[model samples]
Target: MPNSDYSARHLSVLEGLDAVRKRPGMYIGSTDSRGLMHCLWEIIDNSVDEALAGHGNQIDIVLHADTSVEVSDRARGIPVDIEPKTGLSGVEVVFTKLHAGGKFGSGSYAASGGLHGVGASVVNALSQRLDVQVDRDGKTYAMSFRRGEPGVFDDATGISPSNPFKPFEDASVLREVGKVAKGVSGTRVRYWSDPQIFIKDAVFASEELFSRARQTAFLVPGLAIGIEDRRGQEIAKHDFKYDGGIAEFVEYLAKDAALTATWKLSGSGDFNETVPVLDESGNMVSREVSRKCDVDIAVRWGTGYDTEVKSFVNIIATPKGGTHIAGFEQSVLKVLRSQVEANARKLKAGNDKVEKEDALAGLTAVVTVRLAEPQFEGQTKEILGTPAVKNIVANVVSKALLEKFNSPKRDDKSQAALLLEKVVAEMKSRISARTHKETQRRKNALESSSLPTKLVDCRTQETAGSELFIVEGDSALGTAKLARDSEFQALLPIRGKILNVQKASVSDMLSNTECASIIQVLGAGSGRSFDLDVARYGKVILMSDADVDGAHIRTLLLTLFFRYMRPLVEAGRVFAAVPPLHRVEVINAGSKANEVIYTYSQAELEELLSKLAKAGKKYKEPIQRYKGLGEMDADQLAETTMDRSRRTLRRVRVEDAAAAEAMFELLMGNDVAPRRDFIIDSADGFERERIDA
Candidate 1:
């Protein structure tokens, strides 16, 4: 009888690279800059697998002049010999067959991102041309492909066919170094993205690539990765090999104002807590308390009132966390409740209502969990879906807090006392604000409600998903009011830039006429208890001028929504209005009485004139470039920035809410140094020369 084993039973029967190209989005998410980066990541993942296998130490990523990404690694190159079972080369099987790589084996790689072995094949199917060069067997074997099809033929250096997968030495480079082949081996892959597949647009972003490279540099200690641009010019060259590993990651993630001397809150509270708690022994009582877990808790009071809590599962960011995140939140609430109950008499007033979110206002947290096998949900893998991780994390944190409460050397008595004061302050504000906001809501609901005098409310044709265009100036407002399908499209016009809510308090915001107009029109109440579903329009379009001030106003509006109504931003209902920058009118003698022309921008205007000039035509009337939305007529306004079918809208995204909140505090708050440093750091990306000014 044949010795049959699990390896034979587990082999994948499916074949070919056709599925990837047919449904590329399934493999790489989408064909955009993000997807383009994903292609590089897939190849880099192969090298990372090698490192994880303890085979390679060095990896290099380069952007070639021809707009192709190249990744090289000093690892055991893919086997070039024919497989005994299928009579196919290892490199060919890897590139052409799905789930064909060795990482799927029991002992190939203990942990890897590409467990199913679909990375290389998927990349191959989506690429225009791929060049694979392997340094092995004292020879260099090279193969080329166009859109996953073999091209030209295979070329190889001098090496015996019997010993195919020997060692390395790309002969020319070895000769250049004046050394004989020393059996050092590796693999290199270069690929160009297919323009047909990337028709919309997919291009390499060197900076974002470097950022990811730096992430890998930090993730895997003792691993070196070097990145170079198309010009072979070293842009960012860093070797991150940290022996301290995750402890370093923890330290980096725990940075906040409270962790440093820059802590703004250092107050003298009147009350103190003296509670005797049983120790872990249960019999012995201790006055001392200490949070045993080195969770490195840090908090900062930003200029704005927003919360961003980021959690990670095994170094991978879980923006939308699961069980572990829930435990952390529960632990925080537990600590807050303990402190509040202990100092209930000392708390000024109304401290109970300020919940976890209140305590975490302008807060940034990083919760990292180390698990055996983290279960991630979905293809994007942005969330931790593990079931047992919850209990593990919760137990660790709860015990630590309990120990802290029973510590013999407890000093949290002072910290907890001050926190009670802060909670009370927030409580007072919440109560007053809630009352005031409720009264306004009732008044608005009772009366025709002084809905912004300038706001031209279109009839509610249907409660279906409709939109409202908040354009700048009364002229655009009037035009949009006339042209919009009143039932489905509402129009609200603002006088100028709305208040920068990032630097202003809720009270300060009420004074801004423009902001008030928006608030009144939205119908959905703002501040603490804002519900996005109650928003009058399914979408909000910010229509403004085409110049710098318009941009500033747009930023301000974005900031307001992000700081106050973040859920609205997350729901993807917010969008920017895109209107044409120019309009052209054509005229001829005895032509139609309603004769006119249309152009969108300077380029379009120039092109129209060039076409007319080529036809020896002359326009009796000239064209006009609209600097502001007020310049457009009702029909033009509806066609360009109002009509859902023709209009262009840019949706706002809180990709990193924590970073977004930090940005607002730094840019719009009273901190000058942080703002200056931010501008300097992002100078390369920021288009404006005088961003702050």
Candidate 2:
């Protein structure tokens, strides 16, 4: 049933900054607190760009009392003259118009993080009010904006007699305020976010902002960055200035770990390629062109198992890691694998090659590149997409590693040899563990069967369509087995809460019967050997009762998956099945028939009862509440929790690795004081009316 009135006339056009307001997520990613942080980042990036171009050395950030922010830099201020094409002042144009900055084609900046030149305009559009002040040519100029529109001053004064144009009309929106002494030049920006556009009030987190400021100082050497929070009664301030750059960052990250050695490599080169050129004849001619690149790398290996690698382009963090990361990984793998093999030959060890994972384990490294023109993958710039950067970085790193490790006069007990030995030991340990697991599997098969006997297998052989439900207690298992669709759903019943693997080693975890059975059923291996491709089920769901004990059991199982079978959780294959907690029965005014309504929460139950009361429908005396899954019959269980079409499943994911790790440690570790304090703080929010017990 298509509408007959639809035509081309219905299409609407969004002009100027309206498109950004209509679709804020497309520009800043989201309208949550994260988007507010991105807005602050946009303003800070301009100051950072000035530092990168060697124009400034100091950046100061202030969090004001009115939820506004101010960023000041000791760099060349933004242009105060009129732009010929737009016929508007440079400062006014930069804040009001999109894609109007010095980065695009001005050639005023060779390498910079603010590549798109849309930061200032985007921030202005999303802000409620913004102000800009520039000090240049021994005079201070000021201008203001409200929601991306230039503001007019009520009483303007102190105009320069020699000035050619008016202060506020067609020339610059700025008016001269004060005279600068001799050599003071810079730009200052102050902005407040629009409350209507953000989900929550745009409140900045001090710790997160401080971390970013420190990281910027580390990325750009010889730059001083300071942060001041003046929103509270007691003002707090911190300063960061790092001259050692990324090398110091690596050392800081590896301070707590047992490091073998720390090394750094840096190089620069020209990328010569062919380009199209049009001569006087109007024919395209092939001409040789060259682009310059600078690369710096720092690496340190520790005794832990986590690998931390951060990459950047022109002082901008690239968390998603594109071609540059791939090149670095490849170069490290090649160099380490060769070094390990050579050492093995000299020591007369068996023929064993180190895998990429083993070589990179316990490694902390930072990769940075600066080029004349960097091509990023997107506006957010989470990845570097330049093709030549990959080869250049790989070549520089490989040559440096070879010279360091394969030198003729190198000592046998040098730092390189020590690192090689550690990597070899890791390789042998992994091989031995795999061999032992295979042997145990063979022995178990010879005795009877390798599969766990308690598992109720599914009929489908296709892994993509199959699901595995790990049920708690035999009572609930019986109901789930009867209710499940045997064609694609399988059930495995555990005795009780499984072992808490957070405090246990890998060997100890695998030795537990309950943990071992679940691992064998998953078929994805464990720990470092875990692979998503070998998983037996597409969705591994944990089904438990809707009670306190059920929550404890679920937590224990999650701990196991997070510690030993992390790849399964990381691949988005883990889920939690939520069952309804209450059931309401309503009867018509004169009829004996009853209408049943299932509610997942107490609020929903109250609403349902209220609606029935208003409809004048009589109901039973007491509603039936489910304490455990064992209370439901096969049909009831299928309708409430087991049916794929009707069931509600929550997918588990790790959005922030650092936060997740800290949370896990606080809740699962053996520290009693922190756990007690956390419970006490959270108890105030707990509603006793909702707890069935």
Candidate 3:
């Protein structure tokens, strides 16, 4: 189990690009199609870096028939001058040496996708054949490499990677290929992936290339990217150019109806970091420097519940989501939650805190941060490791959103209000969904025993024939239990009025004892997840008193049902039990017993009295008025309100849901002006005798 004889003899030093060929996965990530694509990306990213530096606005990619990919860009070409350190041409040093390029503190590029300086050299080491041409200094210079060796291919037989190759004996030659017009400069690179290092089936993917090109074009506004595929039987070409930047990218990625316009947030911040610098003597040294980070974000909300966020650093996609994404999400949640909390009463959020998912629901955003030599976690560069960028991005986003929310412009104000309302709605929806799930699970785990304690359950097992009567108070519940048909009618009692759910959040409704008990008793879910088929009873009858206060309580119950369990009302299952307001006793002429008549309202009582008087009948002087359901005896309650054959039940119907919702909101919502105006407008048609004063 132990190798005690291990020594320096066991360690062998690899020179030039030999280390890369020995451990290709260490550089390219894998030996499959993904690794092959990574190598292609290394070359394409070099060209993209040039475009990002504002030197070029066009880039082209070609997929050759031989499976070799080529990338050309109208940017500053690779230097042709001799490198002082290596005593070789700049092209040879860049392609042969590891971690050698012009991007390391040369100030040649302000912000670029490549930072490690190993992209070109690593790609060269992994390619069976690589050819690079530079059009600069009014002349075209060409160089070729056969597996990281400076050489020339003898393509006399054919232009293939299997052609004879000769390495430079003493010195490498940089051949002058052709002449170009003055002041024109660019670079073109074509490379064949090494068969020995990659899988045989590894090939360039045209769709991925096109998508990358299009993304690059969008990231670099005004930059045109053209892709041509010669590998296919029919040559295909695609071109992408966008001037709207990430905003257009957001629009292209959005899949639902927009809830808000695309918003742009742009800003910059400065931070200090200590990094290695190349000294004059070619030694590595660490020095602290101040760097500016530019941030640009485009975001829009839609009607869907999905979230789409694409983040990048220096035009390179960070798909795994690093510090920058964290910061962006943090800022979004914080800002939106703050705004929602500030407008809680207006939106009726009612003590529920907004979560990150709520803030991100229906959101589509593109987050970009640009800085010099940002740290990446791996060679693939899918994640950013720089910690300072998080705070910087968060600061920028927070400032931008705060300004928008506080802006006095009407458009900004309207959007801000709507955004807050949407976030609150998402939060409520999430709560409702969670409660529904919990209710389902609880029903399965505890069965019928989990129902509320005060409920007087029906004896019948059939749901279709069972009715649930929501009585006003314990007094009414006692009489209802005695009067109701015990075989199929259940009783649940509530104290006074339940919360006005039209002005309450889902969490608040779920927390209210009466509301929660009612929902639990029904055995069906609520809100978007309400399942009418799972309901424990077919009819949900609200039984209160026969007076004004009872009417208010009934209205509250109706609001709860209409807002949460709306399907029950729409399916014609929700009803209000009408109790008699007056009981009139009439004396028969001689030996007949006195007859009792029940009148539901003053108008009905007057009509009954008029009819009785015209018929020359004598009755008791005093008429009994039912101030509450508790005042009725069991027989009277059963005959007047509980019996299915004799009772009058008003079925709640939503002929026009939109109008009903507006009416409910005007009466029970937190806003008071509309309700006040309604009362004032109806005052002209008031009748004093109709009031239950």
RMSD per model, one decimal: 13.0, 10.8, 17.5
> What are the per-residue Cα lDDT tens digits for candidate 1 across 522-610?
75656665666567678888887777788888888887787667788888889987777766555555756644565655556778889
What pairs collide in candidate 1? 137-167, 288-407, 288-408, 289-407, 289-410, 290-404
Clashing residue pairs in candidate 3, if any? none
Report residue 446 deviation for candidate 1 (angstroms): 7.3
Model 1 gets an lDDT of 0.63
Give per-residue CA lDDT, model 3, range 1-693, as digits (tens): 012322222112125567888888888889898888888888888888888777788889889999888899899898999998777788887887777776779657777775378888888878889999999999999999877777789989877888987766667789998999998999999998888889898878777787887888889999998888898789999999999999999998875457788999999999999999989887999999899999999999875555889999988899998999999999999999888888899999999999988899879999999988989998778899999999999999999999999999998888888788878987887777566556543233236465788989887877888899999999988888889999999999999989988766666787899998888788677765577888888899999887778989999999989878889999999999999999999999879899999998899999999999999997898889888999999999999999989999999999997678678878887768988999999999998777762
Candidate 2, 103: how far from true, in Å? 1.7
Which scores better on lDDT, 2 or 3? 3
The clash number for model 1 is 6
Tens digits of per-residue lDDT for model 2, 1-693:
122322222112114665777778877878887788888888888989888888899999999887889999989998899887667778877887786686754357677776377788888878767779999989999887655656543434522211232113333347798999768999999887877678775578888898888889999899999999999999999999999889898986652234455678788777876656556675778877687889899988865456889898888889999877888889989999877777677644478778888788778999998876577887778888888888889888899878778667555237677677667766764675575455434222235445788999787767897899999999999999899999889899998888876655444576789998888887767767766776778899999888888888999998888766778888889999898898777776556577777898888888888888897877787888899999998988999888988888999897875777667767876556987999999999998876763
Highest TM-score: give the candidate number.
3
Task: Give the 10-residue window scoring lowest on summed lDDT in candidate 2.
Answer: 5-14
Clashes of each: 6, 0, 0
Model 3 lDDT, residue 597, Cα: 96
CA error at residue 113 for candidate 2, angstroms: 0.3
